[model samples]
Target: MLITQCQQADVALLEEHLPSPSRTSFHAQRFARQGVGTSTYLVAWLADRPVANAEIRWNGCAATEVRQAVPNCPEINGLSVTEPLRGGGIGTALIRHAERLAVERGVQRIGLGVDDDGNPRAAALYARLGYRPVVRYLDRWSYTAHDGEVHDIEDPCVFLAKELTSAPTPDLGVRVQ
Candidate 1:
């Protein structure tokens, strides 16, 4: 897989693959954030198709607890891989790519939130990637769907953080689509 910053051109591929609210005017929205240096949205491609996505929020998570605890840490949010191809190291590669990008921007740490009660596999993956639990809270957020329907989500989650050093970028040996 080739990991790179998301572009407007990738929107349709993401839509056909993941088909979620994340694509709700997100091409332009992500571009705005990227242009202003506030966020970086990354897309993972396999065979010229988008298979995964992640975002780096340089200001840290918006949640009050996460902001208070790791103020300068960039949070890696909205990570998702296509369901059929998950478990193939695509998610890991995306995360490492995000971390490398963060280090390039002078970030010393990073974070991501996992569903506390429902996702043991994701928690384990984060643990294996050197993230440690730092804050536990009930997170609430809302999103507008592609069809103009708004949805609210609440989840019990733990935010995991990792200290980033100036380590050499790994040769993930990704196979691009």
Candidate 2:
């Protein structure tokens, strides 16, 4: 599996596979317009087939709970792994990728919101990844569905955060005399 930033070619490929009205397409376009270090779109591929995706937003995000809790921290949003590829560590890789990007930008902390009521497994995963809950609230947002119908979402959510620190350099095990 390979994880990389979405390129122009990747955008076209995402549009073809994911299409608009899906969050994937929306994030891909945002990445194209905003570029890296601001809003980055990442795609996880398995031998050329896109298997998962996530976005790191430096400017801000729609999750009011997370924004209010960590105003200056970058947020990871829209993390999704294809149905058949779930539980294969793709989501973990995407998250780590976002964290690495945040560290590169000198960001000290990162935040994300999970639907606690709807997806307990995801919440568990975040906890296992060292994210601690900071806030709880209802997530309300509106989006146009695939059939061109507007939909309103109001899910109970928990905001989780983790501090980003540089990894310790590996020791070569050489003792100097």
Query: Judged by TM-score, which candidate is best?
Result: 1
RMSD of each: 2.3, 5.9
Estimate TM-scores for all models: 0.89, 0.83
Q: How accurate is candidate 2 locally (lDDT)?
A: 0.75
**Candidate 2: worst-modelled 10 consecutive residues by lDDT:** 168-177
What digit string (tens of lDDT, one per residue) describes model 1 on residues 1-177?
Answer: 688787777766777776666426555565568778899988888877888888887887888988888788888888888888888888999888888877887778899999998988888899999999999977898888767778898899999999998883474686433
Question: On residues 63-110, what C-alpha lDDT tens digit does candidate 2 reach at each position?
Answer: 666677778877787788878778877787788778877887888888
| Model 1 TM-score, all chains together | 0.89
> Alpha carbon lDDT of residue 29, candidate 1?
65
TM-score of predicted structure 2: 0.83
